[model samples]
Target: MELRQLYYFVKVAKKEHVTQAAEELHVAQSAVSRQIHQLEEELGVKLFVQKGRNLQLTPVGQLFLKRAEAILADLERAVIEIQEFMDPEKGEVRLGFPHSLGISLIPQVVASFRKQHPNVKFRFKQGMFPSLIRDLVKGEIDLAFISPFPREHEQVCGEVLLTEELYAILPPGHELSNRHSIELIELKDETFVLFSEGYSLRPIVYEACQEAGFEPKIGFEGEETDTIRGLVAAGMGVSLLPEMALFYSGTLQPVKVRISAPSVTRTIGLIHRKNEKLPLVAKVFHSFLLRYFLDYNAKREQ
Candidate 1:
């Protein structure tokens, strides 16, 4: 039976008067009667009987009325929830980023965004560049913040958010600590502590070292920036890291110096699947991040 017929049947069952049910439903009395009659015919059961001036429900009518009410209520709730999900002010956004950006930059942006759009919830996943890209491609994450900007792909689109110069983190008492800036070549003989192979920063460091006329001698491989910083502090080796990485190194802060000659930097970008529609919440967040970075870059320039 049609949903409209079920609705008419329920209204008639509730009021127990066809005339009043038709008036409440804003339909003609005959139309309501015909729909209810159709419902009874479709179900092969009589739902009501007229006795004197009042209508009484049959035993089957009682059972059907309960189920009909529940179905209508569930449909109403489903409509409301769908509307809220499509509303830009509500729903959840899944975001991905590397460990370094997750430390502060992402948290700060999310906090600020929540102040205005409090109903927009967030789910975050932290991974290296390769993992982030893999998740994005598989639809496990809606958006990602990737470093050095990802290469152009037919299935992916990216916009550069900001660029930060890479710094060399040395042990506190190292001789180079006294210099205002150091070149990558100067550290040619020193061992390096770097993120594992899949991390974006690892390749950036290796390429920069090669550009400076020597291949880096990797002494230790680490998964987290904190661990890498600790290794540097323990004099295991020096490392090249972005500004945010150094900021969150906490108590294990090593000596951070700018790379002077053949300066190296990494670009952070917002990336998502190309031509694929994002959920309303994710789209709102994507717009907010674009504006957030624009304002952030302006302030940094000042």
Candidate 2:
């Protein structure tokens, strides 16, 4: 009739006596008998025969017993598997991030996390932070490494993992490339290539330009950071890029620039639901990111 009934039937079949089965199972013999009768009624088949204080299985009972064993075994294995998943040390994490962070900084974080936890697997997806954050809020991704700007959005919490100062990217042999630090007002008249709308980094750069007292002169718009970098290297335009993007491009060296007006800075970090609990894999990755950036900071200080 139910799992309990099947369990009782299996116990009775194993012990071959209702009295002994009830003794071993801590139930009254009458209850066991009632459960068996209810099971028989439910299945429309008699599964047991009583002979002189002993119980024997009917032909149908033998067949049903095999099925019962399989069912119980499957149930037990399922419980164990679920428990293993809940254990946290083993499992897969679905992670998402923006292209800038994914290409620039996340690879080192992933490498470090893998060394610390080789059994854990990370599934990485690259998208703009707004879309990635939407997925994170909807339970689509377990963790996200991205730059945060929509800071007051509900159901999302972010920690500042690293502070990447934005710098100017210029074509090789460009006039600006010779400067140690270019000011925001310096690029006022220059064409600026940037990531398309909906990118997280756009506002940071655009706002800096605004604070510098002008709207950005948009020449070409793109989505991916690498493409923007490539365009910048070709002298199509210059972009305010995180230092990480420079490492990834390996083509253009980001020129150090000081924008004293607004002091442009991007906070790269892990994002997740405000109330949700992070899995063990994500927690480990978060810790790894913290340490990765801390070590990076120490090295930079040196």
Candidate 3:
């Protein structure tokens, strides 16, 4: 039976009067009676019996009424949940970021956004750049903060949020620690502690060194930046890391020297599925980040 028929039957069963049920439903009594008769015919069971001047529910009617009430209630709740999902101020946004950014940038941005949109919630996933992009493409995340801005793709798009220079991390007493800046070529002969495969930093640094006419002699590889930084601090090897990562590194921080003579830098950006329409909450947060980074860059320039 149709939902409308079930609706009419339930109302008539509750009121125990076809005429009164019709009045409450804003329908003619004959129309309500016809729908109820149609419902009974579809179910192959009589739902009501004549009881002088009023209607009485049959045993089958009582059972069906409970089920119909629950179905209608569930449908109403589903509508409300869908509406909340479309509400910019009250929904959730799934955000992704690389471990490097998660250490500082993502936390700071999310905290500031929460202050302005208190009712909006967030789910965060942390991974390397490649993993983050995979999640973005698979719809596991609404937006991601990734480095190098990813290559052009038909289903993915992004806008660079900020560009940060890369610095060389060295032991406290290393000879180059005294220099204002060092060239990538100078590090060619030195042992390097590089990011493990799949990190965007690895390729950027590798290509930069290659462009400088040498392949870095790799001493060790680590997935986390902090681990690589610690290795540098212990004089294990040298590494190129972003400025933001250096800023947040605490007491274990190694000496960071600027890279010069064809300096290396990387771009961080917000990426998402190109054709997917973001939920209202995610769309607003995306715009908020664009503004946040613009203001951040303006301040850095000052």
Candidate 4:
């Protein structure tokens, strides 16, 4: 019932070792055990059972753990909200981005945003599409940059910044590498280097190839854009990558040809929790990013 008891229970549940949890909490081992026991006594339920040297959560413990974690997270967010509300311009924004955007897009936006709001702080998390979404929904991150923008999620809302083309990246000595633009079908017979199954880009590329009347033969699969580009540059296979990943790609330069026929593209956007208020600092960042990309895309069109 007490905050400290819930905190202790959650930590012990996660680490599953009272001694280790106490070590991390910077508290005495006996104190941690006493608090956990008090918590169980108050609830009249055994939260954990000993298994070998570790503790395993019982079914009730598992359910209580979720609620305890959520309560802690809500309290943390409330504290941040109050702090940010005091001075929105000087508050912190927790932003999440995918690996694909880390090299160029994110850095560019963050650098420019900092120039305008120098005192504003940033906490960043770089992850894949699913992880980013998970963090956003869980309130772990205030806002996130997502691609192939999610259609409709019950717990999320998003706005597309702009759509960017996906290029066919060929190894240096490939036969059609000289062409400025080529059809997706042109690489049908060539082995393809692609993102692994769970990545957002994988499905987009697959559907593009299928639309072009050939199932791509994936010769190599990778989760990182740099890895995929390296594979292509090393003559492992060709790949379709977003425009941003190809910029300033040191030494390992894959030949980036335009995907003319299918014109593969994906939407890049910002997503946040649905029906929830973003912290003041996050709201400022969210607005700034929308305007920034809007102007960016407008200039590109002009």
* Number of the top TM-score candidate: 3
Tens digits of per-residue lDDT, candidate 3, 1-302, equal: 68898789889988999999999999999999899888888889999999998899888888988999999999998887678679999888999988889778888999999999998989999988778878888899989988889768777898999999999888889989999998889888899999988888999999999999999899899998889889999889999999888755467668989988677999998999998899889999999999999999999999
Alpha-carbon shift of residue 285 in model 2 (angstroms):
3.2
For each candidate, give its TM-score against the true structure: 0.75, 0.70, 0.76, 0.73
Q: In model 1, which regions exceed 4 Å deviation? A: 1-81
Clashes of each: 0, 1, 0, 0
The candidates, ranked best first by lDDT, are 4, 1, 3, 2
lDDT of 4 at 227: 92
Ranking of all candidate structures by their TM-score, best first: 3, 1, 4, 2
Worst ten-residue run, lDDT, model 2?
249-258
Better of 1 and 4 by lDDT: 4
The CA lDDT at 177 in model 4 is 92
By summed lDDT, the worst window of 10 consecutive residues in model 1 runs over 244-253
For residue 290, model 3's alpha carbon misses the true position, in angstroms, by 1.4
Q: In angstroms, give how far residue 273 of model 2 lies from its true place.
A: 1.5
Query: Candidate 1 residues 150-172, lDDT tens each?
Result: 77876779799999999999998
Which model scores highest in lDDT? 4
Q: What local lDDT score does residue 196 receive in model 2, on the 0 to 100 scale?
A: 84
lDDT measured at residue 223 in model 4 versus the true structure, 0 to 100 = 87
Which is better, 1 or 2, measured by lDDT? 1
For model 3 the TM-score comes to 0.76
Give per-residue CA lDDT, model 4, range 6-43, as digits (tens).
Answer: 99999999999999999999999999999999999999
Q: What is the lDDT of residue 6 in candidate 4?
A: 91
